[model samples]
Target: MTSAAPHLSILDKPFVLDLFAGPGGLDVAGHALDIPSLGIEWDKSACLTRYEAGLETLHADVSAVRRDAFESLPPEINVLAGGPPCQTYSVAGKGAGRKALAEVKRYIERLMAGDSDEEIDKDLKNLSDPRTALVLEPLRYAIRATRSPNRDYRPYDIIVLEQVREVEELWKHYAKVLEETGLPDGTKYKVIVDVLDTETYGVPQTRSRAVLIARREGLGEPSLPAPTHRAYEAKEWNRRRDLALAQVHQSTLDEETAPEPEARQERGDDLQPWTSMGEVLVTPVGTHPGRDTPFLVRSNYGSSSDPGRRGVRSDQQPAFTVTGKISRFVVFQHLDESIVYEGARFSMNEAGMLQTFPPDYPWSGTAQAQQVGNAVPPLFGAHLLSAALGLPTLAPEALRKPWQPATEEQRAKLRSHGCGAADDCTARCPRPE
Candidate 1:
């Protein structure tokens, strides 16, 4: 959890490939720090984000790239960063997750093959032979397949794999692949990390996520940045608890096991102390989750419904993870708070400010809800990245102003950018059919 790298530094201003970069959260952080990064995402909204920021936006499937193609990227991508899709691994998906697990296996297999565009190309390596899958896990064989490139590329100095849950078996397979690739067994261990509170870094939101730093043999271990904010003195505090709940997953869950549906009307009226939806939402009351707007996650803590929609009380604490899968829908509730905003309500940008995004940052999208929901809070990204790389965070002059510093009026103006200036707490969100 609190991973102490053998010792690492991004003083070199590493190049990074943000695989599955949701709206450039990780990519922007690296860029702001003067690190060159390319974001690979399949979503159009996310790609637009990359384009607007003047960063390279590669529209491709990460698992589809050839290993040689990776070489085409920066020589020492100092960090290979990405958080693979975790929807399949979520407990909420229940027994229906078999396909997702299978996908993870296939994705890793393709990655082992050198992750190239020639996924089904001529002369594909049969590395993931049926014989190899068994040794790796249910799908270990996938790692041996060597990917060919469309343009030709190679590997980076280290690969940082991010994910909501640990997926121990996946790491096991990774270690096995490293051995096969000529790296020793011990060097194959993945360095998992926990995210610090973004608020400490000046982002109004309290987002936390897991980071994995992996290195090849002889590289010593990859380094992680030290926390710049003084939120907690115990550097190790976040590390251990951040390991996440995958270790204790139900392994079996269903609608029967789901938290009993709360009474919407009752919750809407007398939401308990520390249970108000506005607090976690961090906006003026009455302008969220409806009218084509997405929910805002003030913290990772909240029902697995509309993450940004419902808010927690002033003191209940954050929920474990965020992402569309496990998060609750906004038709349910919003975090508790009553800060006023534009149109007499706050906007996603305002909410994102709460979640942390650079003020000058531009998000191009008609779907504000989906865009904000999927983003990796820039502040969230900056916190972990700067700490892991043992670097300092950017000064305000070099980036957009902090979100909370904005007056209630400034926040409302930002909210209006993506959505029409409209606030309707009563509108059903996530479009319950």
Candidate 2:
């Protein structure tokens, strides 16, 4: 088993409180970093998976949780992280949040301007999708942690947030607010926001997310994680495929066919090739019974350019964005498109693996597909968290390695940091034995 690189402990000791945490994607990354994490999620299905995995969890709605509630936890949470529900903002959904982007920004502006929750909630309740307003919840918590006059005002040292790419503008607005809000000590947060491709972070799917990372100025400069892997380009892949075909035909007439040069130069001096689905699914997970036979995946969703046509990807390429409806995707033997592959679709374990979850991850409860799809791939989350803390970049091999379950020592450390100890937890918060 390959071990992760030595963790560079930037913070004295970090405790993370994740909001709208679904099935512990970021939390898993946190565990790998030896950082204790507590996730608050409202989805019973996701919570079930969390419990089965023995992750620290508070199964409750983010909106219902008080902004200042972190004050009461046993250990002071220095890191605030979460990926808020992005259904309303995602293009695959109704696009209600996109439609209300301006209105939502106004709500964020009001929150930063000291608008009362009652006032914001009143108007927010009228949005087409109330979930659109929930995007502001992280900011609400941040404001209270930094500015609230409650006893012992302790500000978070770091704040990390992620959402669908459509929410990049809102994340920029968040960066603006966080940079302007100074802590009691007059030190402000250094903030950076960008749209990150999961594939660049070594995830086997090509999902894009808007990410914001902010660290207290005293800690050090904050920046997004550098991509460790080159992003996969479909056009480039197609071009290479056509060239290979042409070369094959010419080789019959000529004595020899010139070797195809590298398909494309690496994105960076040190970046590795983009990870393909075949690298993960074909060998480790055995998606195809014929070990040598390649396969093609027919995506359930359509592309922006061709809405009527279903998207297709070869096993040699990274998967299209994994979605809640991924179960609807079909797989075919590469040589025969008409015949469905033995494994027509991804199993729950296979689906979770595509999202960077461990193959043996315990996925319980209903809507398991949604749980897998909605997760921030743990591999990407690890790199993001490492960058936020001003730590060394995770080696590409570390990100690509299969996830292992938390060790007993890791569980003990989490308990020391107050995992699974929420007083108001509405669901089963299982303690590691």
Candidate 3:
């Protein structure tokens, strides 16, 4: 007798299990889309931020969680998403993951060969940076889910994974592995892998992330979401140069005759110009509220090729990639080296806003800058999740709107039961008594 076909429709509710989830960037998107999500994060500071935001979280290492724990959760999880720790592979850090790429590939081979977890764990411990092995945890979860012996087992309907651009090769290998090793029930996955630029999706930063999306065969082949905004171009800044001079050199222009560049302008064919720092930081989102002056950002860290020359970008451009060191960047009024902008360094809220998080997102604990910088932009995450589920993309206005604040009751709970109390306490903090 033939097994029943898997349910493959957007109408089916999607419950997300995000591994290595950091401060609810994707969870914020999930909430906006009205999807319930649970994130597993290991960092105390990140978990504290999640608590402040009222997002569901489990404060434990991804490797320590058992598949049976997931199997026991109510409502059932059908979606798997994660942006694993990328410092080892990032350009900003020592290239430990890059050096270990071949060894990592060998580990994948062992996993495919049905090697015991004990053997894999022993070898992974021997890697230069043990964190490099964490990238493979998602794959282990996927494999176990597909080959489950449980009578009611259902493999994830959608899988989304992202990392720094260097991990694109690994994601490609994952595509090959999933295709070659079909599900135990003979259903296969159609996978798409690519590097996505956040600015193209209307995020206010020009960050790129390697993304992989997989869906079961009956769900149809997955494709990357189409860009809804034009990519940021340096030439675009030249067009706005005179306007910046006008803001600084002359009185404010007449509102009716010459309006400040609108937050969004329609180009033909459902695309808008890339969002600028001025639109987010200077205007509506109000990183520098009530300030109409144009400014320039001086990056603290110079480019790889020119370490001596500091990188500079006008407010008209999308921000240079916001890194963990974002607090070190300095802002100036126009090109005048002598005049510092009133808000010289972006506040934590401003940095978070540039990452497409709401301005009021309650960032908690030390290393808040690192938390904001490491997060996936919620707007970009929303678009990816929508595309993976074959649903309509979120409205452009959704990106601009502020995220809802946590309820008073939720705030009281966080205050009363702090995440630092203990590991088990943090885990229980977000759940109902």
Model 2: per-residue Cα lDDT at residue 40 = 85
Q: In model 3, which runs have C-alpha deviations exceeding 4 angstroms?
A: 1-11, 67-75, 147-151, 183-187, 235-270, 284-291, 334-342, 411-433
Candidate 2: give the clashing pairs: none
Which portions of model 2 miss their true places by more than 4 Å?
A: 1-7, 67-71, 147-151, 181-187, 254-268, 285-292, 335-342, 396-433
Q: List the residue pairs that clash in candidate 3.
A: none
Q: Over the stretch 285-378, how does candidate 2's per-residue lDDT look in tens digits?
A: 3232323447788898889756677988877778899888888888777545345554557877778778887667778789999888889898
Question: Candidate 2, residue 254: CA error in Å?
Answer: 4.3
- Candidate 3 similarity to native, TM-score: 0.84
For model 1, residues 281-398, the per-residue Cα lDDT tens digits are: 4433223332221233233333455534444321113322334422232222223334422222334544444445555356665565556656776655764565556556554233
TM-score of each: 0.54, 0.85, 0.84
Ranking by lDDT: 3, 2, 1
* Descending-TM-score candidate ranking: 2, 3, 1
- The lDDT values for all models are 0.44, 0.75, 0.76
lDDT of candidate 3? 0.76
Error (Å) of candidate 1 at residue 391 is 2.8
Off by over 4 Å in 1: 1-13, 64-78, 92-154, 166-190, 193-203, 206-208, 223-311, 315-345, 393-433
Say which candidate scores most in TM-score: 2
* lDDT at position 284, candidate 3: 54
Error of 2 at 114 (Å): 1.7
